[model samples]
Target chain A: MSSVRLLVGTRKGGFVLTSDGKRQDWKVEGPFFAGWEIYHMKGSPVDPDRIWASQSSGWSGQVLQRSDDGGKTWNVAGNKFLYEGEAGTHQWYDGTPHPWEFKRVWHLEPSLSCADTVYAGVEDAAMFKTTDGGTTWNELPGLRKHGTGKDWQPGAGGMCLHSIVIDPTDEQRMFIAISAAGAFRTDDGGGTWKPINKGLHSKYIPNPTAEVGHCVHHIAMHPSKPKTLFMQKHWDVMRTDDAGENWSKVSGNLPTDFGFVIDVHAHEPETIFVVPIKSDSEHFPMEGQLKVFRSKTGGNEWEPLSRGLPQKDCYVNVLRDAMSVDRMDECGIYFGTTGGQVYASPDGGENWQAIVRDLPAVLSVEVQTLP
Target chain B: MVRVELPAHLCRLAGVGHEVTVAVDASPVTIAAVLEVLEHDYPALEGTIREHETKQRRAWLRFFVCEEDWSHIGMDAVLPPAIVSGKQPLLVIGAIAGG
Candidate 1:
């Protein structure tokens, strides 16, 4: 039997919603680690029973927990994320170098081939990996040691390495994205990395198309076509054909291109999704209406999916990590909002329903297609 | 024996009752000894109340014994007789962050 599990991480806790593939009739399971900020929760693509969550509190600091039996129980793993070497410096808002600092883990990405291996993306922007099921994390320093790292600056979100894409065809290659620092790719399994924001243009920065310093909100890649990537930047919706070596504007027909969170359909390599906000400064839906623009032709042509979404007086921003898609034959799309709602569309984005309307403001949403 | 009380969230996380009593393993027990036992018994609390590397108390946490703030004192300093004997439960509180 096929099934679906939705892992919803909110500002206050984490929840698990399960359904028997029908995508109807769900059983909502938690508020796990109540009152704590569950920055991200994800299950391993290779092993659905294995899940990882990044739980943090201002009072308790950061803690990583691993669940082997699909969230039935959790073991607190390594929370220590010590920067290797001197933990160098990056440019500050004032254009002066400021030392790098370790903040909470912003996202956890499990290995596609093994359940025990996972990656942790942390703020103050750095990358880490754990091969022993999150028991310990070792810094993959090459990403930060890139020559131009000192020139990287933080966006208002604080310099976070929020997006990670594993190249399925090549075991040794991987890609990571950082806000205000653009994107970086590693050909040697994270040992080394290079900035890949060649065609990106950010008017706010000193150079519109500098190699780095673009506030990329999120990036997505289809498993089938790992070379082609889609990105939702702070301003433009973009696409990369040569695995991020170059990018081109794909904002196309989006009403407003300034938004966070972008994802590709599980089965369609060219079909993508993006929730357009009014602008970077406004952070809300345009004209008080919420619409999810879907581009079936990759980009440049989009149609609004508002059948079941709020069409009037709705004002909630979707954070960078709050959108995801499941892999069932029919395909499913799910997203959470800052206004405490988790919306789901079992059949693509044709129609929607709120899985839970009043959760604490959601920070991230991930769904696993279970077989 | 040293009786101890953890903050609400910590208690729930540690899966212990409001008060926990642990064998100090030595006389004139210090706060450090109590924490060592607490962490050993509840491994989930490894870096929650105090740091794993520096062993420094989390900035948002407080320690108290006999109604006196012991957070400023060294972790190795001996506790008062009342606390060491279980007459007073050393309190580990999450310092309020409200303005």
Candidate 2:
């Protein structure tokens, strides 16, 4: 009998929720990585033995950690990218200091094809890649070179690369979404990237191109259909079939299209999930009502799943990387909220149950199945 | 010496339903001392206030002095006279999350 483990990362620490395959009784063990802000945690789909986490501190910028024996223990693997170099070679570059300085790691994506390959998105709009199992990392130069002119502005979290999706079969192909920089993709690895933001709205740009900052929050890809992608933007939920060459709004039926995270089923490519929140006003759920909606045929239509959720007026917001679908025959959907609660659905979003409540602010959720 | 206040969670852990006061005599007050006093008097908060595995400060927990964040302040840094004098309570808060 296989076991299921849910690694819940929170603002204060990380918790590991384990259960039998049925997920009926869960045992919570944590706050692992105790004193660190764990923004993202993932168990490598390619290699279940490898688990990775992205952590940050108020004073300690960002750190990447990994574990081989599930979440029993963790080890820090890399040095954070600090703007200042050693002693006295140089102090301040120009009148203004260098911009490599970062305060936190906002997201982490372990490549589906490679066990050691991982990507980290951090504060101050920086993206880093670790090919050697996070022991060493290199900054994605193309992203650094992209000019964030007056039109490309950073939001509350700064202009960070919050989402990165690498094609499972094609390691060279990848897509990255910047908070205000829109979405960009690379076919020949990171050698070059092209903005693919056509038909997306950017309040800052007079004419938003399919290639640059359009206030993108998150992006998800269907498992079977490599080209099919879904994105949650500031004002709309959009989809692209031609590999991001073009996009169209598919969120007319949602209670509110404004959402932070978007997820697709592991095996059923057509089935997708999203947590809808009231936009424009502080990004909370509608009238404090939180619902996770699933769309079987892409984002054309959605069904609400909140059977076992809180009955009170609960206005909770789910962050990007806060919701995920476990890779199994009967897929399980899990999501953590800012309100410090984690909800799980064994039958993919058909019904829901709160696995753990009032733990802390949940920053991210990653699920792994033990063989 | 500056004073600090405790939220409900920390207060419960401290074994006191209400806020308790601490004295900081030197600069760069170590979190260890604060925890020692808390544990010696409160006891109930011993396990939760520190890391379960390493006994270090939990990353998600924050220490604040009035409106200023005390995360970067070294463990040895001296507390302001007001704090030592019990004028204001050093606030130990759990970071808030949701959005």
CA lDDT, every prediction? 0.91, 0.74
DockQ for all models:
0.71, 0.04
Q: Name the runs in model 2 displaced over 4 angstroms.
A: A82-100, A147-151, A204-211, B1-99
lDDT accuracy of residue A161 in candidate 1: 96
Model 2 Cα displacement at A345 (Å)?
0.4
Off by over 4 Å in 1: B26-28
- Superposition TM-score, candidate 2 onto the true structure: 0.75
The CAPRI category of model 1 is medium
Candidate 1 residues A1-371, lDDT tens each?
79999999998889998998878788898898888899999999888888999998889989887888998887788888888898889999999999998878999988889888999999889999999888889999999889889999999989999999999999678889999999899999899998999899999999999998999999999989989999999999999999998899999878889999999999888899999999878999998888899999999999999989988899999999999999999889999999999999999899998888999999999998888
What are the clash counts of all predictions, listed in order? 0, 41
